[model samples]
Target: MLNSIGIPGLIIILVIILIIFGPSKLPKLGRSIGESLKNFKDSTKDVIIDEEDEKKEQKQ
Candidate 1:
């Protein structure tokens, strides 16, 4: 899917995003997205740890 967007298409998309979002809000928006992704990663990590603990308890 991503490969379908060549350099020109990518540039156009970025330009549109910049216009819609604006420069000032872009950093804040990027940070917000980064945080949400981090939260998702952390939650998945916790779930994996819980599963490991459960398996260990079962083995014991």
Candidate 2:
């Protein structure tokens, strides 16, 4: 779904966010989003490793 949104679309969306949230709050919002994504990535990596370990145990 995001793939369909090209550079122009992204720029428009960003502009909208800027208008809605204003410049002062944008930094805080961006930081929170970054942290959320980082946590999500770490959790997904752990899940993948656990699945691989389970598969290895089954094979043995």
Candidate 3:
């Protein structure tokens, strides 16, 4: 989905977000988004690991 956006589209979106959020709040917003993504990634990794372990146990 995002593959179609390209750099210009991304820049436009960022500009819109900046206008809406303002420079003062941008850092906080970015930090929040980063933490959310990190948590999501960690959970995804845990799920994959659990699935792999389950598959190994089933084979054994």
Q: How does model 1 fare in lDDT? A: 0.97
Tens-digit lDDT track of model 2 for 1-60: 999999999999999999999999999999999999999999999999999999999999
Local distance difference test, per candidate? Answer: 0.97, 1.00, 0.99
Candidate 2 lDDT at 54 equals: 100
Candidate 3 local lDDT, 1-60, one digit each (tens): 999999999999999999999999999999999999999999999999999999999999
* C-alpha lDDT of residue 12 in model 1: 99
* Candidate 1 residue pairs that clash: none
Q: Which of candidates 1 and 2 reaches a greater lDDT? A: 2
Give the better candidate number (2 or 3) by lDDT. 2
Candidate 2 ranges with C-alpha deviation above 4 Å: none
Residue 48 in candidate 1, Cα distance off native in Å: 0.4
Q: Residues 1-60, candidate 1, lDDT per residue (tens digit)? A: 999989999999989999999999999999999999999999999999999999999999
Q: Which candidate has the highest TM-score of all?
A: 3
Q: Write down the worst ten-residue block by lDDT for model 2.
A: 1-10
Counting only residues 3 or more apart in sequence or on different chains, how many pairs clash (N, Cα, C under 3 Å) in candidate 2?
Answer: 0
Ranking by lDDT: 2, 3, 1
